[model samples]
Target chain A: MSSIISLKHLYKEYQLGDGSVFTALRDINLDIHEGEFSAIVGPSGSGKSTLMHMIGLLDKPSRGEIIINSRDVSTIDDNQTSTLRNSYVGFVFQQFNLLNKLTVQENILLPATYSRRNLDFDPIARSEMLMEKFGIISKKDSYPNRISGGQQQRVAVARALIMKPQLILADEPTGNLDHKTGNEIIDLFEELNKSEGITLIMVTHERELAERTRRQIRVLDGEVISDKKK
Target chain B: MKLQGVSTLFTSSFADFKRDKVRTALTSLGIMIGVLSVVLLIALGLGLKNYIQNQFESLGANLVMILPGSGFSGGRGPAGLAGGAEFDEKDVRSVEKVPNIKYVVPVYIHSSVITTADKEISGSIMGANEEIFSLINIDVQTGELWKKTDVEKKAKVAVLGNTLAQDLYGNPSDALGKTIRVGGMRIKVIGIANKIGNQERDGAAFIPYTTTFGSMNPKKTFFAIYLGIADKESVTTVKSEVEKTLLKRYDKDRFSVTEQSEILSTVDQIFGILNIFLVAIGSISLMVGGIGIMNIMYATVTERTREVGIRRALGATTRDILLQFLTESTMLSLFGGIVGLIVAWIIVLIVRNWFPVALNLFAVILAIGVSSGIGIFFGVFPAKKAADLSPMEAIRYE
Candidate 1:
């Protein structure tokens, strides 16, 4: 299968207020293929989030080439970068990040509202289907604050999948959920990966959740220590 | 962005505004106060101008005043007054020869004490021809005006104004046929003029012009000449003709003619300037209100930094975010502007019951335009600041 994301020699650096430079990621080289269900496991501040941001086109690498869906990200401007992100990437954050003011349906339809490309299908009909699949249809009119953490995360996941992007990037998706709820979310991600053949890249510190993915790339001190394929 | 997308942004913005009712109401109040003041000021100015014009119209149509010397000259009143050009019987005769001339009533005015059986009061005694009654639309409330024979015969008959008669005899109707002593002469009051609301006409007494000039004081010249034209449209023609006739005998700088339209226009011009000055004062408050909106919107941008990142991450372009915020602040100011208009309208309604203020649609529209302009203008800086935020940094903001 063709690779969906190719990161070649990606490096990210931050400038401290004291004028010292701190490198977040160095000489990172990795490829995430289509239909690959993978988890990036690492300790805190090990550059797992930085790598995820770079892969999602949420931030630029300090020095490197990032090719996503066969297009080099460096050549694209901010507007085109946003278009690329909207067209091919979906993100699930640890905080769920649903706007508190928006109801579940409005939050789920947010991606479609922001997409510049013309959508072929009705976003509302698809949102209804996704809510049914996620078992949260009854809470569709409720705001994010009124729902439980698990329901909010499910709504966030539904939002990420609303545009049917080529790849989904989840950062600590189960960090705030109970163990049983986290396992249930993991099961949903596995089902989506197996049924739709959607590429899934998740960042997590939970070793047990990382073990359930088809592959695990463990990062330690900004370097991938092991890449194990199940 | 598509219309649908813009509408969605507006929907969210409105929901966001509704979430904090107190802040929104207070923010809108700033703009409301500014708009209300501007609208009311303009309305009052226009209303006052209209009221004064109507009063001028009530004096008489087709009436013109010929003043001695230039109007710009100091220490001179209207015609025949001291310290300027002297206009007497010859000037009146010359003005009578002008085409479309109806009645040339030369007034010999004097201030004196009049005594009746019951009281004594100081008042102006005007000596004019019988045409003065019709020229100034003065109706007789009791008895009749003096005849042309009464003026030409130099009769010592008098007409008392409504207020003057009331002051002298305590009743306008009872004052008829009663003799009032002025300048040591006992004159019988032949008529009482209707209430015309002018201090000169409503509170003074009138005597025959020939009697005052020929019998009372043959040396006293006429003070002013009032010309009643045959047709309202012929006023300008008659005025120029009278000026030309006078210029033939005297210098061009010796006299000036003022039509009712000229007076009305000068009054209108003064009120127009006043309207502009008042509106400018009101706009300063509007500008402050705009700045207040800007200050609050800037704070809103800072407060919503995390929200901006979340939207950007959800695929909102920089343009999208910019337009969203611009729409939000513009709507905020527009909301205030509309509320201000409503409040202004209510105030105007209340004021109309007490004063003669005409509501001006143009001024109202201009107020709305200014408010919207302020919103868009002041909102740009803060909206730009919000749009320029880095999405990655924003999303990470706590």
Candidate 2:
């Protein structure tokens, strides 16, 4: 399989209040293949969230070469970084982060609205299809506050997939849901990865959830401790 | 940006306003009051100025009153009477020599009663020289004016105003040759002056100064002088020559010369002061309204933090965020200003109907400019606050 995202010798550091430096990610190199369902698993303070943020293009690494579809994004400015994120990346935050004021359909259409490329797909039809596929079609017009947590997460996932991005970065997408809902969300991600041929990168502390993916990487205290094919 | 897009922003703003109707109404009320105060105050000032100007016009155009005083300073008493010195027939003769002096009339005034065979009306008798008719531009409606020959001979001929003629004789035409007793002396009605409405002259009766001084009060001195300049451009030269002539006649600082230019300038000064006073009051109200706008904008920024975050995350530049808030503020203010202008115009119409004032367009334009400026000035800080929000922090904000 062709690699959709490649990171070489990535390093991310943060300045502590006392002037010391804390390394969040060090000497990390990884390749995310097309149509792969992968997870970065770690304990608390293990830099798993930081790695997810860097991969999502939501944060810049201190030193790294990140090539997504042959574009070197690490050297790009903020505007260009946003453009790259809009064109090639999708993010599903742990807390859902659905805009409370927007309806479920509006939330789902947000990514498409922000993306650099204009998709000619009908928003209403696409929102209805995603909602119907996720078994939340009845909540399409409802506000985020009116929907359940699992439904809101489904809406976020729908929003993430709206732009048909090359890579889907999920930072603990199911962390806030119950076991059944978490399993259902993971199943949905797997289904999307297999059928749509889109890459999936998830972060989680749950071993069972991380074990479900085809590839798993474990981080400990800002360092990748292990990488294995499940 | 596209018109459709701008309209969409407006629609969303209105929707948000609708969601919080009470707050929106309260904010709009603040702006409304501010704009209303500004518009109404300026309108009122303009209306008063127009009324005063019209009153002066009715008095006559380029009409200057030169009273006997010391050196153009003490001519008239505090009540516009001939006080310190007396301007007599000789001064009138001298003033006529000045170029552009269209007519100079010396007046001797007295309060008296006029009586016919059947009726009597009491009013002021204006004893004026023959030139008074031309100086005041009085139109004769009946019979001939008291001629210069009549003034030199002191002919007992009177020109009754329309009202006085109606009072003394039921038919003004019949009174043309009829005799009336004024101040116990009989005088023939030679002419009936045209009616000039319910002004000071409406109740007056004119007679030749020669006849008045020689027949009724021969020992009394002349009271005041009135001069008519040909046009506005000639007023300054005529006034200067009249002043120099008067100063040569009277003691220094004893006589006062007042011109239309001086009176108009005084009126302008009064109006200017009134404008400043009213604008200050309006500005205070506008500031209060601006504060309300600021508070509302701040609340909007807080409430829409997540939306701001979403836009920022979606590649919205800071300037775009700033422009959005500014557009909202400007829209609010512009609508408020328009409403204020309409209300002011309506009120001006009502005032014009009920009073003697007219609305000036300058006031209207000034109100709009100031109100819109207030809106933008007050909107900037809030817009900046909204634009400066960090995407990460705003996204995390509840």
Candidate 3:
């Protein structure tokens, strides 16, 4: 399979109040292929989340490169990076991050609303289809808070897929859900990966959650410890 | 950003205002008061200006006046209250002899308590020649004006204004043939003038200028000379001749020859300055309103930090976040401005009977423009703060 994203000697650093540099990720090389269901797993502060940020193009690395479609994200300006994110990346946060003001339909349409360019497909049609598949079509008019936690996560997933992005970045997507609900979310991702050739990247601290995915990349203390394809 | 995106953003921002209705009103209230005071004050100023303009227009425009001292240079001469060249009978006669000058009416003015048997009013009395009535468009409502023979004989006959006649005798016609004291001299009221809606003329009593020499003006010098031009085309020729005649008697610095339109334009210039001054005073409140918007926007930006991060992560550019907050604040101020304008318009309409208050187009434009400008000016800093937020940290924030 063709690689959708590739990283070369990636590094991330932060400056503390004492003027000392804090290295969040160091000397990392990785690639995520299309139609693959993968997980970047580690304990908290293992730089697993930081690595996700770099891959998502939500941040700029202090050193090394991130390549998507042969373009270096580090070399681009913030606005260009934004355009890249809009066209290529989709993100799901642990908290769901659904705006309280909009209805579920509007929340699902949020990504398409902020797109600087017109999308290839009709956003309403795609959103309706996604909602139908997720079985939350009846709750389309309700607010995110008015619905159950699992439904809110479903709406968030619908939002992430609205742009038909090259990859979906789920950051601790099941961290807030119960075990049963979390398993359902993972099953949904697996189905999309299998049935529609969608690339899925899940970030989690739990090893069991990581093992459930087709590929697992383990990280500890700003370094990758292992990469395994089951 | 695309127009569709902007519209959606506006909808989102407007929805934010609905969550905290009380705060929204309170935030816009500052701008409301600012626009309110500005429009109201300007209305009052315009009303007064209109009143003055109507008064001047009522008098025929084919006229000129010679004042002592350089009049209407935006500064009064050292003539001290009754300042300027004290034009007398000789100056009047010389100006009257100038070609195209129809009639030269000399005037002597004084303030006095005019009294009847049971009533007295502090009033201004104007003493002029018999031709003054026609020259100044003073139409009589009752009885007849004094003939030219009365002024030659220095007759103790006075014409009362409609309001003044009403005040002393309770009816304008009741004032005719009654004797009222002008200063210390008793004069018989010969006529009651038409109600002209001009404050100065409506309140003053008119009499023969010759009669005032002994009691009202011991110096025997006329206050001003009013010249009615025979033809409109000869006004300029007559004006220069009158100026030359006056300059021969007194220094040019001590006297001025002014046409009717020049006087009107000078009044317009004075009102322009007055309007600017009033607007400056109003701007202080508008600025305060802007600052209020800014303060609210800063709080909004801080509160929405996580929201901003989410939008950015969803591919919203920094420009989008900045524009969203700016549009919201501008909408707040514009709302305030429109509300304030409506209130001011209602007030102007109510007071229009007594005062000629006008809610003009310039005021409307200024209200909308100033409110919008204030919103943008004050909203910049807070929007910058929001745009500069790091998405990862903001989303991770508790």
Best by lDDT: 3
Summarize candidate 3's per-residue lDDT along B254-359 as a digit string, tens digits. 8777787887888898888899999999989999999999998998888888888888898888898888888888889998998999989999999998889998
TM-score of each model, in listed order: 0.84, 0.76, 0.92
Accuracy of chain B in candidate 3 (TM-score): 0.92
lDDT of each: 0.86, 0.77, 0.87
When 1 and 3 are scored with TM-score, the better candidate is 3
Name the runs in model 1 displaced over 4 angstroms.
Answer: B1-3, B59-61, B68-94, B107-129, B136-223, B231-241, B244-255
User: Which numbered prediction scores highest in TM-score against the true structure?
Assistant: 3
Rank order by TM-score, top first? 3, 1, 2
Query: How would the candidate models be sorted by lDDT, starting from the highest?
Result: 3, 1, 2
Model 3 clash number: 5
> Clash pairs of candidate 1?
B69-B254
- The DockQ scores of all candidates, in the order shown, are 0.46, 0.22, 0.52
What is residue B361's positional error in candidate 3, in angstroms? 3.1
Error of 2 at B126 (Å): 7.8
| Superior by DockQ: candidate 1 or candidate 3 | 3
User: Which residues of candidate 3, in runs, are more than 4 Å off?
Assistant: B1-3, B73-76, B79-85, B169-179, B184-186, B247-253
* DockQ result, candidate 1: 0.46
Per-residue C-alpha lDDT of model 2 across residues A77-124, encoded as one tens digit per residue: 766766666657777877888877668887787655544445566666
